[model samples]
Target chain A: MTPSSFVKLDGVAKRWNGQLGVEGISLDIPEGSFTALLGPSGCGKSTTLRLLAGLELPDEGTISIDGKDVTTSAASDRNLSMVFQSYALFPHLSVAENVVFGLKVRRVSKKERQVKLHRALEITGLLGYERRKPGELSGGQRQRVALARAIVAGQRLCLMDEPLSNLDAKLRNAVRKDIKKLQRDLGITVVYVTHDQTEAMSMADTVVLMKDGHIQQIGSPDDLYSRPNNTFVAEFVGAPPMALIDATAFASVFDNSATVGIRAENIQIVPSGQGRLRCVVTESEFLGAETLIGLDHAGASGLCVLKPGLAMVAEGSEIDIDFQDESLHVFDADGQRLTG
Target chain B: MSAHANLERRRQAIYGWLLLSPAAVLLTLFAFYPSIATLWSSLFSRGTRRRPSEFVGGENYTDLFADPTFWLVVKNNLLYAGVTIPVSIFIALSMALWANSKISARGFVRTAYFTPTVLPMIAAANLWLFFYTPGLGVLDQIGSVFGLPSVNWLGQPETALWAIIIVTIWKEAGFFMIFYLAALQTIPEDLKEAADIEGASRWTYTRRIVLPLLMPTTLFIAVNAIINSVKLIDHLFILTKGGPSDASKLILYYIWEMAFAFFDAPSAAAMTIMVIAVLGVVAAVQFFYLDRRTHYQ
Candidate 1:
């Protein structure tokens, strides 16, 4: 009911056979914003995207697009376009034909279809490659073709399901930036599904973190990383993910918290006698711009700190590390954030 | 190139030829030799009790061209092919779609549709004969229930060839369905999901996406169907025996009658050569024209 809400799902749930695929899901996507449903595999992120695309029907609750209930509408009737994980370009069709497939299906006039196809292909940087079939294109080119196909439909909302997963690491990074820029330029609502946190963090205006068919947190990337609502979100949102420490291990530092979380970058290594927690350096890895120091203390393993430049501490050397007080995240017994 | 590398290359060539020798030998003996021998023999006259075999030099071919029975059988075979190929393919596609769907008793339905494929051609022909037998046949019995006259399904020239065409389609469609089913399964489920989201109707998806994707399979099945139309004469033997005044006499059955029943070897050889030439033209058209339109990937 919010003024900004364009696409809304109210208590939506879907089941495959007798088992639940996604349940009790509610979300409001603001118009023209890039949103990401992010989770590990089997986390119901894809099922949610398919439900929104109208490829799968929800068993409960209602889905409304622009104030119109479309819970029972056919996928074609919903007027939404999607790019699949496999690209799913018609192998028999040329890239140009693939892009204009939706227009042809809708009986759009030839002149309009050609205009849209040209614009889409030009935007996706696939202008001259339009004559080539999908089988002839490389992975990144095929992905762009899928993107061109989705955008050519001129639908207000577009869904993408791991569209860059098929590309190489270098191509993935390039295409990720292309997609982010394209979304901004086109001003279309995008619901992207990704298991990779980096993709979600880099591309989304609002990242919806999911686990086991339920949303753990929904916020901006910075909000998710700095102020995670639960242990799951805290552990999921960042690279060298935030580590959860037993509260009892640091009794003096934590009084009532069940779990304490700290980012690797926030742990400062100082002289052994000046710090609160002391541990022996176990391993050190030299990454190009930063070095990561791994530490183990008393039976609990897992303290990794990122130090700028080459800082190598010899193995078995005792070191003292102090947690930055502002960066410490405390959680209650129920795994929810314990706010002051 | 160095001498050692050159020797190794020669060795590899010999090894490759050695590996291919068995297939080459079988093809030469069974296919190439028979084809050339048929053509060569068609140029000679059949030996008789008083006259020894003599060089005919196109006489047999000229007689074959002038023969009414030969032309009639050729016409019948062409009709059989024109009717069977497309109809069987369409039915096979439908059967594949049904078998691939999430219908109840899906396993049983697939097995039932595929059952005729494993049945012997003669056995299938005999079974259909029982169904087409005038008054006692299943079809006539069903018709009689509606008080419709007991029609002669295979006993009259008007309906005999059509009855043969129907039975051939039934026998071969299930076999063709297996190929179509395999092709259908290979299509990524994501394509269908993508089509759905792209706002394509089911008919549009099948026509534009599914059918185009299936072209390679259709081409493959068409080649098989064409060959079967010429070679599968077991049904003709059991059902009509090219009877009702040769109304359903295909080229292969006519060749058999000419060669064995009437002992006209030279004429039969000429007819066989003609059939081979027709098949060659079909293969050429498939490889050159249809293959260009088929998307292999």
Candidate 2:
């Protein structure tokens, strides 16, 4: 493990009855950085978070947090807190009671508990909700309570497992900013797990995309979006996803086995018989500010072009789309990114 | 429009009454009428062939107050309620927690814990009857193997109520456990995980989270256990018939004796009225007080 990494996992592997839960996992998280484990459901993003939280022990390799080996440490012994997807606020407990639960468990003095609880509640904007039971609070308020509880202990490391998944869309957006601000203000290292690309891209300093029990790519959001390491990352990390085109279509430039990838924003919808490749408009989705025009081609999947304004293109209309040769991401037959 | 609104209101009123009619009819026929009839009968004197039944207000109530046997049965039931309600609830809670854990043979364990509930109470009493049958019983057989004396369980005043209490607890704990198990499952596993991360010990989690979450279930089980202490006297008939000296005589058993064995219907009716009043107050207290404090999801 690197000395500079605040939390490090060295070749960590976990399994369920000899089946692959997660394998050959290695990561180094710096202090006070937001790292999101992003993937589809059942992609072991949750397994990775649980392993880091010390909730699940890996079958092989070591996990270290804050430069200490916590491979087999109990969750509490690791001195880290967690925010569950369900919020997990004790239903019978008031908001103040839930926030101070960890402090009380750690036997912190009454005065200190009160001080910390007050500060945590204030930071989460839940000052007036202290006396409310979780059941009595709105979904957004309950989420803040979970956040307050996670931070009340002043643990330097916080693990959040899709904490905003339970909230509605508008509340999710607000809480997203709140959580990002909270992490920034506290300077706490966070390991967040999410299946939502928007959440990961918008908040995380580093986004680790995984597929089928293995890390596909680990980099900044821009790195995953602009330069995906594999075909899966290309398709999984964007809003509309990157389009995949068979290299055979670009007969002169690419190897027959290679696949070419391009973003919708980079592809321009030129007039028919003028652009490089011909495509038929499959569907058009008007997203207020911009309309996304989905295109269908013989050798491509997820071909789309972003048109500004309500560009209602008719379905089955032939259109020619073009992208600069430099913008094309070339992946070999094995689906691994090929360096220029 | 106002007429249409009135018509709609009338339709809604009719729908509401239609929905409530079944319950109202059942209660009036079986519960309300019987309670009022019992009260009316309690105010009258039992009739012989020579003298017809006559009004004797407060006489049967006073006679019950003067009866030593009634006091003894009341005391016996009080002790029974105190022991069986708490003990059975405690056992049920423990059994529920154990069975809900991730253990091997979990299905078998749950089935074993639930077996007593599946058996009829009389059949269960019969099964315990074999265990309390002096020299030929299971308890005595085990005692003898340990070189201990085989004492008569059902025939003695001191041990008869205790033996019945044990039987009631054994038969009841399993039934209460099913409710506890259902309540336990409703408490999400996430709470335990959250507690684990909070540095709370397992016992602390149980006390702070699990136990409080189970308050509604505990209150329900307590009410059922109290009612069963009085109502489930079927075992008394099969085991001791309210015992050698009325030692195991619960209030319901004594009431049955007053009505059928002694043919004193008025006194039995008075006792039943008292039972109903006490139960009503208790149910009201539990509903009003504990319901507000409980967190139901």
Candidate 3:
């Protein structure tokens, strides 16, 4: 364990109704770093966040926050704050009252509560909405109110469970940037939970990819994208995931019992009979900046090539495509990456 | 084109009213017409064997106002309402919290709580009658084991109304609990977790978050309880018969006795009109005052 680790979990496990929620999970989150628990639904990303927030107690393990074992402690004693996906703002209270609820519960002085409330509202861009009820606010405004409430509580560790999932696309982007900026400015450690890879990759200092109650990989977004630990991480980290093909199909490139992985962007098209492999275009999607051509190679589906700048490739056209050797990822038969 | 659009709108309005006519006609016949008829009759004198009915404007109301029994029953009804509404609502909320919690045999507990609601008020009154009966009653039998003297629960003026109030509360609380339980279920679980993470104590969370969120449900249940208090006079017919000097007689019970037992329709009609006016005021207060404060999605 690193001496600088601010939060540590050792072999944390949780079971719900005799089924594993998560098991054998260990992590060391550094101080003031923004880490994201990124995975698909039901992959225990939210469960991990809940555990850190002390909402759910681990069935097996010790959870230490700043060198204090809080595995058996109540959530209220954890000295953390959470922003929910539903916002969870008190509907009856005005925006100012909602933001100051934690301070009031702790019996903080009225003056200090007001000062913190004002600062939180200012940070979240909700200063003018002090008198509006949560029901009176828009989705984005409500989300900001929830953020302001968490910030005003002044907890050093803030947990957010898919907080931006409720907003529309444009508003989500704006709020995402705002949350990132707020975290950096406050120097508070944040553990964000998200199923959206784009959200995790764009905002997090470290992305902890999980699947099926296990951690797949934990690293910077570029590390996972450039050198995935396994086939799952390779496919999960990118925009359009990397394609896995049989090693025999690329026998001339390498003679090994492995799965050949190549991203869509690394496959280049050339004149027929000139490149290493020949294929026929089955479908073409024109996405303005790039055209994705779906190719049929040796009965393998989803062998796609992303061509830059509106390349027009008609259906059933014969084409030669070659993999970028330097960019190719080789995974062994067990699906583990063969090299760093 | 404008004429065509106008014709289309007229046709749509006719269709709308056509669909609503059945319920509208039923409400007029059963609800509106009776209220109007009762008000119209309240201004007149009751017909007797030797004399025809006469149009004595405000005479029935004047007589009603002068009657001490009328005032006493109104006080009793108010006391009954004052006791039953808040106590029953509090018990219902507690019961809902229990039923919604992760307790053993939860389904059985919910069913047991709701069973009293499903039982007819008359049958429930009969069941309670055995419990309130002196000496040989279940309550007295239990008291005897504790070496306590037999107490006449429904005989005295002070205890008679209270006994009836207890029975009404027992019956009505379970029905209101179903509403509270449904509302509690609709509250997101994440809110509780969020409260926990915010370092709010359980009591604080319930007061600041849970209870405020439940205000709409409380209002809804309160309105139902008010209506039930007026309509639920069936137990009185079997339990106390408003007995020992009309001690437990509510407005509805007195109105029934005046109309059927005394055959004084004008007096009964006047009391009925008064009841309707009180209910109208309550509805207005609920709609204009409370509704504005409630948050609904």
Query: Residue-wise lDDT of candidate 3 within B63-94, one digit each (tens)?
Result: 99999999999999999999999999999999
Candidates, DockQ: 0.81, 0.81, 0.72
**TM-score per model over all chains:** 0.97, 0.97, 0.96
Error of 3 at A248 (Å): 0.9
Clash pairs detected, candidate 1: A76-B199
True contacts kept of each: 0.86, 0.80, 0.80
Those runs of model 1 whose alpha carbons end farther than 4 Å from true positions after fitting are A1-3, A299-301, B1-5
Off by over 4 Å in 3: A1-3, A252-255, A299-301, B1-5
Model 1 clashes, total count: 1
- Backbone clashes, each candidate: 1, 0, 0
lDDT of 1 by residue, B13-125 (tens): 99999999999999999999999999999999999999988998999999988899888898999999999999999999999988998899988988898899899998999
lDDT of 3 at B153: 91
**Docking level for model 3:** medium
Tell me the TM-score of chain B in each candidate: 0.97, 0.98, 0.97
TM-score of chain A of each: 0.96, 0.98, 0.96
DockQ of 2: 0.81
